[model samples]
Target: MEEQLQATPICGRHRALNALMAPFGGWDMPIQYEGIIAEHSWCRSSSALFDICHMGEFIFQGDFVADGLEDVFTFSVQTIPLGRSRYGFLLNERGGIVDDLIVFRLAEDKVMIVVNAATAPKDFAVIKERLTGGSFTDITAATGKLDLQGPLSRYVMVEVFGEEVATLPYFRFITLNILGVEAIVSRTGYTGELGYEIFIPADKVGELWDLLLEDERVKPAGLGARDVLRLEVGYSLYGSDIDEETTPLEAGLEGFVNFETTFVGKEALLRQKEQGPPRQKVAFEVNGRRSPRHFYDICSGGENVGMVTSGVFSPMVGKGIGIGFVLPELAVVGTPLTICHERITMEATVCELPFFKDGSVRG
Candidate 1:
């Protein structure tokens, strides 16, 4: 049997609200406070707050080029301006992704890396071993993160956080006083909506949560709704869609990898680029409301072709949609496929990503 999971500081609050609790990455996190669809709709129509404290954070203070940090990720860290962040991946020698992360250039000599919870420890170890200069520290325990997402997220944030947040452009962050502690508000989120991710001191996180809940326009959402939102937008979940065994090129994330710089996985990526990828990532939409799920088989012409990595019943599209890896030839748009599982199968068609195209993500 699996060991009992630990709970967050807001576990009592979630329990008081009758939230559905489940173990995720060793934490007893709230799956849903109300219903998944209801919370998802609320986020799309109004504003929703998400407790993202389960994610991990790290701080590295050193020369970007000399400390070997510049070449650690797929993107160049030295070119990133202070108070701005860029998303990329850390890869193994074989070009397989170790972890997908966002690096915030706090200063010329300081940077912060935000990574997924499930890959946190492995990411730390891999990053540290590759460093040749500067000191690195895991600041996850000292940091807490929250995401407020939706079309109305901007208005709601300006009302609660401050007017300064209104000026933040995409991928930019500003340090502000929140709950009597310095917090960083970044115009970034997983959901393809206008959103902000607030990073505050851990001790003050609960207070910030309560204050946000006090707003009539804001409702507390959970990971269940978050999953649906991200899937609908075609954003890849770290462990589910990409893993250590998966290369970014095959995962449909080659844009994040920069070959102009020297990195650990450059040689392998160059080789893969010269020789076509073995498999390619593809997105599809179901014909009906029945949703595909992880590990579901993708079949074409009565033959198994691929495997679903992440899927959900899309609230925005009012249909089922999924992303999976399949043979390169079968990844064309309009290709008919079948999603198969134990005693169940559904008809689907290969389609473009972002099942819901009408979003305020850039606005």
Candidate 2:
């Protein structure tokens, strides 16, 4: 028998909105509200709200060094100033990425670790085993997260939350009061838009969600739209793009890793740095509107070279864009490639990332 999937506090609300539901990360999540394309467009032009309660949240309170937390990830924890967050990866002993996550420093001796939903349990276990001393606790069940994204998201947040949210820079967060309860509002998002992530008590999330949608400019977007928005910005999905067998170096994400840091996979990364990765990640664009799908073959001169990890027909780009792994020589810009499935085939060219530019993320 299959395990029962979890539901968020706003599941009833999503159903009321006639959302398309599907299983994601062991949870029954909303795949779309009105339609994927419409919602995706709303997020790029106006504002789109997303229910992000399925993701994981953890809290750690204690000595950063004595608890061995300083060396658990690729970047140092002690260096993160208050009200700021840093993105990096947790790697295995072989230098393969375990999970890409963000660390938020809440106070002098307290921090919050946010991770992908599917890997939450394993991430918690791995982190616990690494820490010699710390007050670590998984707060996923009690915590609720919602994301508001798009070019006008900042205006929406300021109107609903407060003016304080208007000035919050990217990757920064602040503790504020909402609905008579303390909450964390972070200027971070996955949609490659000017956005805010609001964290509040699980019971109060539904209320917040309802209040935010009161604005005429804000519409609810589901995971389907979220996936497209993230892909357009070249953000890698944890399980598909980078997994236990993929390293940051090969994924074109080495900038997130600090070579001077003493982390669990330092030696292996050093070795790989000297030896070079066998396969490297590449971004490509199809010649036409034909979309590439996962596991599709990537060929060069009729020779199988790689496989597509993520692909989509981008509304913003007006073409198909994909990310995949291939031989290092074939990962260069302008390189010709053929994407093939059982019968369908399309010509493509290697390209730089962020297939859809002109995002208001930094504005």
Q: What's the TM-score of each model vs. the native? A: 0.98, 0.99
Candidate 1 lDDT, 184-283, residue by residue in tens: 9999998888899999998888898898888888899999999999999899998899988889999889999888888998999899989989999999
Candidate 1 lDDT for residue 177: 88
lDDT of 2 by residue, 1-363 (tens): 896899999999999999999999999999999999999999999999999999999999999999899999999999999999999999999999989999999999999999999999999999999999979999999999999999998888888888998889999999999898989999899989999899999999999999999999999999999999999999999999999999999999999998877999989999989998888999999999999988999999999999999999999999999999999999999999999999999999999988988899987
Clash totals, every prediction: 0, 0
Q: Could you tell me the C-alpha RMSD of candidate 2 in Å?
A: 0.7
lDDT of each: 0.91, 0.95
Which portions of model 2 miss their true places by more than 4 Å? Answer: none
Q: Give the Cα-based TM-score of candidate 1 against the true structure.
A: 0.98
